[model samples]
Target: MALYDVLLALDPSPVVALNRAAAVAMRDGPEAGLALLEELAGARRLRDYHPYLLARADLLHRLGRLPEAAEAYRAALAAAGSEPERTHLRRRLAALAEAGHEV
Candidate 1:
């Protein structure tokens, strides 16, 4: 199948968007992936999705938007329903704080 067709087929799937955003980040740049995440956030589609918020936080961190990245990580932690996920988010948050970020 064509790339566009495959993407279209997975358009309704959040996992697809998340992975696609990651791919875009790798292929184009963090800015492009961030744009997609922002769009998803604005739509309130992935507000409670840990991976979505995590991806946003990582992108913000890469862009040097440390404050926003911290916020995103916290949000992801809050929405994380699994203990392991919470632990991971906490680790990420701690790393950011240790980096002198105002988390």
Candidate 2:
């Protein structure tokens, strides 16, 4: 944890932040991860990063923030260039919608 903190403070890269956020989520809870992702989203640094949005959306979905999750998934899909990634996002979106989510 201390190592992650040092790295985050020294580098502050989105990838580092994301890893730190994942660590926090595992150590703390989904809320912690969501908070970190929200901060990153506000910074607009991971707008074009598919994994970032997918992580945010997954966290939101798990937290029952379906509408926001759907939006995040859509954003991820829009930015996704690979067929596999787009298929995955579409599948998730479809699953959410099928589960009565407002996608």
Candidate 3:
């Protein structure tokens, strides 16, 4: 988190911001990380980035926001750059669907 903060001060790149948000989510809570992701969602550079959607999906999943997480996972799958990533996101989405509202 400290490294990401320093790098963010110097660069504020979308990728760095994404990592920082993940770290914050890990240390603080999923809501904190989701807030940062929300802030970055408007950035043109990350509008279609798979990582951003994936991160949001992960946080939502942790928070037990199943429907939102499932949607975000689908979006991440659509934006995924690699077949493996898409497959992983698909599995997550499928699991959520199988769980239904119980998740």
Candidate 4:
């Protein structure tokens, strides 16, 4: 995490920021991470990045924001680079459906 802070200070790269957001989510909570992601909403590099979308979806899901999570999962699914990633996202969407939110 310290390394991330240093790297971000030096580079301010969107990918590194996203990674730091994930780490913050792990150490703090979904809301904190979601806040960081919100700060990066305008980052062009993350617009179609599946991993960024995945992190946001996971955090929203953890926070019980099912509809938002489903939307993010849909976006992630669309951006996914592999069949396995698509399958995983599909399962997450199915779970949201089971929870009464359609993706």
Best by lDDT: 4
What is the TM-score ranking, best to worst? 4, 3, 2, 1
Error of 4 at 21 (Å): 0.6
Q: In model 3, which residue pairs have backbone atoms overlapping below 3 Å? A: none
Question: What does candidate 2's lDDT look like per residue over 11-96, in tens digits?
Answer: 98988898888788878888999898778875567778888878888888888889999998998899898999999999999999
Residue 76, model 1: lDDT of: 88
Candidate 1's TM-score = 0.83
Q: In model 3, which regions exceed 4 Å deviation? A: none
User: What TM value does model 4 have?
Assistant: 0.96
Query: What is the lDDT for 54 in model 1?
Result: 85
lDDT of 3: 0.89
Spell out the clash pairs found in candidate 4: none
* Alpha-carbon TM-score of each model against the true structure: 0.83, 0.88, 0.92, 0.96
Name the better of 1 and 2 by TM-score. 2
Query: What is the model-wide C-alpha lDDT for candidate 1?
Result: 0.83
Residues 1-103, candidate 3, lDDT per residue (tens digit)?
Answer: 7788899999979989999999999999999999999999988888888889899999999999888888888889889999899889878977887886532
Q: How many backbone clashes does candidate 1 have?
A: 0
Clashing pairs in 1: none
TM-score of predicted model 3?
Answer: 0.92
lDDT of each: 0.83, 0.87, 0.89, 0.94
